[model samples]
Every structure is written in C-alpha cells, then in structure tokens.
Target: MITIPREIKEFIELQGIFAVGTTGVNNIPNISPRIFFRVDENVIYWLDFFKHKSYKNIQANPWVTISVFNKDDLKGFQFRGIVNFITDEPTKLEIKESIIKKTLEKNSSEKIKKLSEKIEVQVIRFEPKVCYSLNPDEFSDMCIGSDVDSTQLFQK
Candidate 1:
C-alpha cells in the first residue's frame, strides 16, 4: 500500500477531472473521465450520471481505481479503493449547491438550474486504500545515470 502525501492530495483537489476505472462482475474493466473533488483525507467524491458506463460498472462491483494528473507537468497520483453510491436528495442538493457556489459563482440561478438538469447527480464516495505518486524529478538521478528511457516513466 502507498501513502498519499499532502501535496498529492492538494493537487487532486485542485484538478477538475480524474479518470475513474472500474470492473464489472464478469471482470470486464471500464474506464471513464469524471469530475471529482476531495471530501476528506480518506474519501473522494464524484458526480455520477446514471447514464454512464462507470455507474453501471460501480453497481456491479464497488471496487475502483482513480487517476488524476497535471497535463503539463506529467506528474500525478493514482488511488485504489472501494466505492459507494449516495443518492439521498438532501445530501445531493447540498453537494450540488456547494459545487455551484465554488465553481459557478457568477452564474444566475436559471443557468445553474439548466446545468443541474443535464446532470443526473449521483455522488460516488471512494475510500482509498492505496495511493501512488508519479514524479519524474524524483528519478532524475537514475535517469541520468542509466541508459533507460526516462520519458517512458511519464507515459502512463
């Protein structure tokens, strides 16, 4: 198991999108892009629409992995954990309000209403068990000393 550093946690919180990976009951894996945010040190939340493959996969199997990275920096983190679906209307509304307040501060209620209508708005809570950080700088010495391609490290 890998521990998540504070910096990594902060990075994830700041990022807008993360890739979510899930497997079905038959062991078929599925991956999709999602907008997410951190709820706490151990938990991360995603807004899931009932129409996506991710939602179907999660219903079949709760275990999942999520990856988020800096597009320009080639540095990121991966999280593996169990997922739970939250559909309580009150909780969903609260989260939706908070997200709107933070991300769409200037938008009017009519605009917010239209935006909310398009989203099915299910919250997925992930309780992470393992986390890994990929930092190229940390392996700079090895890259310079060895003949192996350092760029390969950032491919994933």
Candidate 2:
C-alpha cells in the first residue's frame, strides 16, 4: 500500500476530468476520461457510468493507471494501482446524492435529475501503489511508490 501526497490530492480536487488507463488484448493500453470521482486520503473512488470498454478491461486485468492534469497549466499527477468495484447499496446511495447535488447546482430539469439519480452506477475504489508528479521541465519529479524512502514516499 502507498500513500498519496496532499499536493497531488489538492490538484485532483480542482479538476473535473481524469483519464484512466487500462490494458486490453496483446497488452494494448486503453485510456478513458472519467468525469465523476472523489479522492479520500490515499484511496480514490469514482462512479463507473455505463460500464464501457474500460470496465471490461479492468475485469480482465486489475492493474490500472490514472492521469490527472490541471486544465489550466497541464501540470498534474499520474496514479498507478489496482481497483476494486463496489456495487453495494451504500455506494449507490452515495452516487444518488452526488447526482442530486450536481443537479441542484446546475439547476437542471427535475425530471432529468430524477432519472439520473435512478441510473445504476458502479463505484470503483482504487488503491494507489505509485504516483509521479508531472511537468514539462522535469517530466517526472516527486515520485511516491511502494517503498517509502527519503526521496520517495513508497515503493511496490
């Protein structure tokens, strides 16, 4: 298990979209944009809407990576780890609450909001194993992997 840095968590909170990378056949990697996610400590959870190709890929391979860059400066962090899916009622209730909150914020149609809240969404829990700070100058700086060291936080 690895701990995600506070700086990285702050960066993630400000962004709405994050890209998740998963491996497919022949080790080909597939990246998809995720819209609904929240980071809690070292754990990240997201609503898996539609259960698309990426979902299928995760079923085949547990290893995955997430890339989140601030849209303003393109500076961000990459989180690598394995994922666990949550289909329980608690997760569903959380998703419903999130949807309702967003709907209220956006002031969208009540009927639409009602339908959205009813839609089944899979909750994905990710345990981060590694994280790398990204930038154009250094590219890879401030890395935290499985083994927590002086230079890094953890190393797998």
Candidate 3:
C-alpha cells in the first residue's frame, strides 16, 4: 500500500466531489462525477447513489482511478486502486451521516433529503496503489516529498 503524502492528503480531503473512472471491456473507461465522496488518510470512499455503470464495472473489475482536479488550473492528483464494497451496515450508516452533514453544508435541506432518498447507499472503500501528480512542476514546488515520482507513484 502506498502512504499518502500530507500535502496530497489535505488537498484531496478538501474536495467535495470526485471523478471516478472504471474500465469496461477492451480497456475503455467510463468516468462519472460522484458528489458524495470522501478522502481519508489511506483510502477514499464514495457512495454509489445508483447501481449505475461504474458499479457494474467495479463488480467485473475492482481496479479504478479516482481524480479531483481544479477546473481552473487542472492541477490535482489521480489515484489508482483496488476497491471493495463496504457491506457492513454500521459503517454504511456512519458514512450516510457524514455525507448528510457535508452535503447539508452546501445544499438545502429539501435537496439533501431528495438526494438521500435516491441513494442506493453502496459505499466503496478504495485502497490506492498509486498517487500521481497532475503537474510535475507544481508538485515539486509543493515540497511534498522526494519519494513521490510525480509521474508514477507506484510500481507494478
């Protein structure tokens, strides 16, 4: 498992949403915007509100790439990882509460309720194997660490 650098960890945790990419057959990928997501120290979790294409793809292939980039600057980190579903009801409930809190901060109560109702509530726990910087130059200036390749954070 790859240890997340502090700078990258803080940057990711501030994100309200993420782009989750899952590959289909022939290595084609489907990328989707997932609003209900969180980045932890060593893992990332996002609620699959619907059992959509990404969910199906995860079932077939656990490997996924998740990214959160600045719309203006296009600077961020992308992580590649293996994911497994969080089946425990307790953890799922906790995640729900956290999501509700986070969502409520920036959304109306009615909207939050509507969003909550639509949730299939499938929580995915991603254990990242790599953390690649979006820009090598900017990444260096951040002075995060010497260990990160800034190009490729992991070895196959």
Candidate 4:
C-alpha cells in the first residue's frame, strides 16, 4: 500500500518542475520534465501539445508516474497514477489562466506567447494511486526496510 502525508502534498505543490514517466507498448520507458499543478489530493494537471513523445506514449498507455522535490531540502514525492487527456474548452481556458499566472510572473509577454504557441495546452491529469516520500535525515535508517522498495517506487 502507498501512503500520502501532508509533507508530501505541500512539497509537490511548492515545486516548479516535476518529472513524468511513461511506458510504451513494448515496455520501453520515457521520462520528461513538466510544469504542473495539483488539482486535488490525488490529481495533478499539466499541459502538453499534440507533439512530443510523452504525449504519444500516454495516448498509447495511460499508466504514468510523476516525481517532484524541493531543491533546498531534497525531500520529495513520487506519484504513480493513471493519465487522462483533457481538451475541453473550459478546461483549456482554466489551463491558460494557470499558465499565465504561473509563467507571466517572471517572463516577458513575447516569451509567454512563444511558449503558448508551441503548446496547445492539452491537460494531462494524473490520479495518484501510490505515493512515496523521502526525508533523508530522520528516515535514513528506514531506507532499506523490507516493505519499502525505492527502485520500484520510481519505476514505471
């Protein structure tokens, strides 16, 4: 079983970049960096254009894992979930607003537009089924416990 703690939730929401992993039909794996938002306790959302190998892999296989961390603390969460592609107009607008708010704060209009054009902003929603959190100091001894497998936690 997987557990999600408050610390993990807070860490995921505060991070700017997360890595998403997907597997192909033949079981080959791919990973990509994504800018995402937490829609709820178990759901994460990110935009992807029709382009990109990640999107193609998800379309072929909805199983995926997302990982995020705090750079300063090195504490983070690994999320395993099902992927859903969303392209409705209202969802698109919501995504646009989110992108504008999150990106425009530190970017110029030209840069924003260029990025917006490059991305059609299809939302990739992840509904987490399992989660693993790392706290290097206090939990260092627990790293090798029989019940916990760090390698499997991050694997797709």
Quick one: best TM-score, which candidate?
3
lDDT of 3 by residue, 1-156 (tens): 667777776676566677889985556789998777666767777788778788889998898988777766667887778899999899988976786677667666686568777746788898887666776456523423333453553335
Q: Candidate 3, 82: how far from true, in Å? A: 0.7
In terms of TM-score, how similar is model 2 to the real structure? 0.76
TM-score of each: 0.70, 0.76, 0.78, 0.72
What are the per-model numbers of colliding residue pairs?
0, 9, 0, 0
In order, the Cα lDDT scores of the candidates are 0.66, 0.73, 0.74, 0.67
What digit string (tens of lDDT, one per residue) describes model 4 on residues 60-99? 8897988777778777666666788776889767866786
Ranking by lDDT: 3, 2, 4, 1
Per-residue C-alpha lDDT of model 2 across residues 3-86, encoded as one tens digit per residue: 776777777766766899998555788898865667777788776766778888889887788999875696878877889787
**lDDT (Cα, tens digit) per residue for candidate 1, span 1-156:** 234556666787677678999988777888897653445555777666555677888889887888888978888777667898777888877776566555454445675446556656777778776555656556423321212243453244
User: What's the lDDT for residue 117 in model 1?
Assistant: 60
Clashing pairs in 2: 145-154, 145-155, 146-154, 146-155, 146-156, 147-154, 147-155, 148-153, 148-154
